[model samples]
Target: MKKTKKLFGALTLTLLLGLIVGCGSSGEDKNSADSSNKGTTDIQKIKDAGVIKVGVKEDVPNFGYMNPDTNKNEGMEPDIARLIAKELTGSEDNVEFVGVTAKTRGPLLDNGELDMVIATFTITDERKETYNFTTPYYKDEVGFLVRKADKLTDTASLDGKTIGVVQSATTKEAIEKQAKELGVSFKYQELGSYPELKTALTSKRIDAFSVDKSILTGYVDDSTEILKDGFSPQEYGIATKKANTELNDKLNKSIEQWEKDGTLEKIYKKWNLD
Candidate 1:
């Protein structure tokens, strides 16, 4: 009878020990999974990959453009991307530039196809909620590039005219608000790119190719001229995924340093943007 009692006690003790061991093993596995699957930070992930992918406009000359001759992106924004790459991976060549339009940059960033977007992204309160933007590296205002023959001498002349703006760009809003205040109105046509808007203007489809003045500067030819009037001061900033605070902070630091040291001015001058 004592033997029976001893065996039963042993069996109970073993079961309790097994339960404790199983629980401990389960906890260890859960911790290991969390460490392995969710451990890397956004910037750390870029560092681990040894490259930083950036979205840039391939058509907006001087801001971000694809140079047909060299088949490389060359512009103020691409130069800025190079600087960021230097800051991140210790070499400017460690950066890759993917062409993106206003409508596409956000999705590319969201889908993790790009690490950051330096594609003349404007900073606004609404956009701030969806992505992290650094302090404004450049400021510009919306303007109109109309054919000289159209004689669009001022904003008032834009009444009853069709203005072309890039899709997902803020220029349309700027124009509408200003036009309303000025007691004038116009029609709007949205295009996929700056070049498309320019072509539309050249082909007489859109009366004016309207965008930021600096961008307008890129499309002006003998037939086209920018109106003296401008509106909606746009503050351009580098944008990263909403969850990438580390990269955003790092970029802001770089922009601040550049602003202080005139590096940004140098880049602007290099691209004839100043």
Candidate 2:
């Protein structure tokens, strides 16, 4: 009877030990997985993925626009993005261009959909809280594009008129502040995309379109002319996820090197921005 009791006790102890060991192994595996995931930075992940994903504009010509014939993104933004990719991965060909507008770029970067954004993204203190931005690679100013027949010679002429601006862009606020300071009042229509704003302007749904002067240059022709006065100066920067300081540092270094080597100036001149 004692032997039977001893055997039962041993079995119970063995089962308890097995359960403890199993739980410990599971915990270790979970910890390992967490550590593995946390060990890689954003740039490291891009390197491992073998391609850098870049968010760029598809409509803003000369900055980031798609070529209809080539069916590829071509512009200063794309050039800069490719240069970064080449610097990081040793090949500009190893880049994937993702189309993003002003409103979508922030959320896409935050969600890890883009490794970086080079889509004429302006650097501001508010945006600094959410993402890391590199040194300004380009500078621009806010201006208006109006039909020549309207005879709108300056920003003040747009008082009491409707203007179209891209949603989530800083142009509207800049214009509003400037207008208020100048004692002028005007209404603005927020469009979801730049093309929509262009359409609104052409259809006379809005008297003018307001945005960065560099962007407006692409849409201007004989019928449209940019206003002589600009409202705000904007600095464009490359943006990455907030936690990706390594990538930002590398990008800043690349920009510094490019500036020193005259590569930046060459690109600016190529785009007629110099």
Return the top candidate by TM-score: 2
Using all chains and alpha carbons, the TM-scores for the candidates as numbered come to 0.91, 0.93
lDDT of 2: 0.91
Top-lDDT candidate index: 1
Where does model 2 exceed 4 Å of error? 1-8, 30-39
Query: Model 1, 1-274: lDDT tens per residue?
Result: 9999999999999999999999999999999999986878777788899999999999988999999999999999999999988877889999989999999999999999999999989999999999999999999999999999877789998899999999998889989999989999999999898888999999999998898999889899999899999899999999998888888999999999999999999998998885
Can you write out model 2's per-residue Cα lDDT over 163-233, one digit (the tens) per residue? 89999988888988899898999998999988898888888999999999999999997889998998689
Residue 64, model 2, lDDT:
92
Candidate 2: minimum summed lDDT over ten consecutive residues — where? 41-50
Model 2 TM-score is: 0.93
Number of backbone clashes in candidate 1: 0
Worst 10 residues of 1 by lDDT: 37-46
Cα shift from native, residue 101, model 2 (Å): 1.0
Candidate 2, RMSD to the unseen true structure: 1.9
